[model samples]
Target: MKRFDEIDEHNYSSDLIDEMFKLITPEAQAKTHYRMGLAAKIDDALKAKGWKNQDLAKALNIKSSSLVSKWLSGTHNFTVDTLVLIQMALGIQLLDVGEEDKPNATSPDNGNTPNAPVELAKNIDAIKQSLTSVANSNQKSFATINYK
Candidate 1:
């Protein structure tokens, strides 16, 4: 067995250990986890659409296959713009926010039907945000959406 000093030369024999080391920073760990989550979502979407990396890149107007390869590698730190573009182009949601991220729903996927109040409030909030965005884009004045 190699001594601890030998292993301390910034090298590790185990791939798992190496990966763990890469996640030593809290920020890096969170970012890596998020990246992997998005990567898994992208992988599922590709499989569902029967698309190769080239197909998605072409659809997203991304000319570089290498960039797509990096995205699929589960290590790419995607920008919000890139994520938004991908979601808009593919029509597949990769990130869940607000009520969408909440587990409570009124159906098999949504919140429980018995608990309508919570779900209703969430739906209203989502609609309000949509309306606000639409109204703003149309140069119409509207009340800002408040969490309350």
Candidate 2:
């Protein structure tokens, strides 16, 4: 038997952790990814608005800023109402629920088709900003979308 102090650093194998991660279902992984992505977006919006954790808490009517921190940690499962409240407070769209799908010429996945679903865009904000800049400018707008 090897004592904890006696064990070398190389004695531990990360394969067990890798196998444990492999046990997670694709749906579970996707859910986690979306949650973490949403949390990141929230953090970005907060920074853009120059708001602190306490400010967000105040906006959400939450008494504890710690709870807001938990929400930003990406582990918290957010309720729809809470999400709506957050969206309202931050002036950002957290979720596009119950909206009809519109094919965007800006998206490469849709291939300018009206019927194709616009795959979730990672750079939608950047694209929008660029488009806005082009619109404001007299130059012709040419957008290049790279979707993963």
Candidate 3:
């Protein structure tokens, strides 16, 4: 059988898939991005610690490396407890709750207020940090990045 790449471009078109992707809700897209971002963070942490899927599986106390593979594939529906376990094992924060130095305040909206757009920008920055921390792993120290 011919490989997919060997097929003539004229024989197929990506319009259907493209349109389907376009139909996806922004919320769904954001969820996918965050899931993939978390996966990348875990993969980077494993590499930095000179570990493999088996090592992580052992650390996580799972019998199957395939489970780790699924997590790395960015499709795992990770639970908060599982995330905490992974964070503990890897010594990295998979989710950024807020600024460490800042005091916590109880918002009336529980943070989803009239200033939600501003808060969203900050949340995006936190996501960026998780996604890019591996690139800066070699640095001795770095300043905290604030998105204003």
Give the TM-score of each candidate: 0.52, 0.59, 0.58
Alpha carbon lDDT at 121, candidate 3 = 66
Q: Relative to the unseen true structure, what is the C-alpha lDDT of residue 15 in candidate 2, on a scale of 0 to 100?
A: 82
CA deviation > 4 Å runs, candidate 3: 1-13, 100-148
Q: What lDDT score belongs to each candidate, Candidate 1 first?
A: 0.72, 0.75, 0.77
Q: Looking at candidate 1, what is the lDDT of residue 130?
A: 100
Each model's backbone clash number: 6, 0, 0
- Clash pairs for candidate 3: none
lDDT of 3 by residue, 1-148 (tens): 5679897978765789889988987567656766787898899999999999999999989999899999999888899999999999999988657664443232234334422345566788898998788668735344455447
- Candidate maximizing lDDT: 3
| C-alpha RMSD (angstroms) for model 2 | 16.0
**Native-to-model Cα distance after best TM-score fit, residue 89 in candidate 3, in Å:** 0.5
**Ten-residue stretch with the least lDDT total in model 2:** 113-122
Q: Sort every candidate by lDDT, greatest first.
A: 3, 2, 1
- Which portions of model 1 miss their true places by more than 4 Å? 1-23, 104-148
C-alpha RMSD by candidate, in order: 15.8, 16.0, 17.6
Error of 3 at 94 (Å): 0.6
Pitting candidate 1 against candidate 3, the one with the higher TM-score is 3
Q: Quote the positional error of residue 137 for candidate 3 in Å.
A: 54
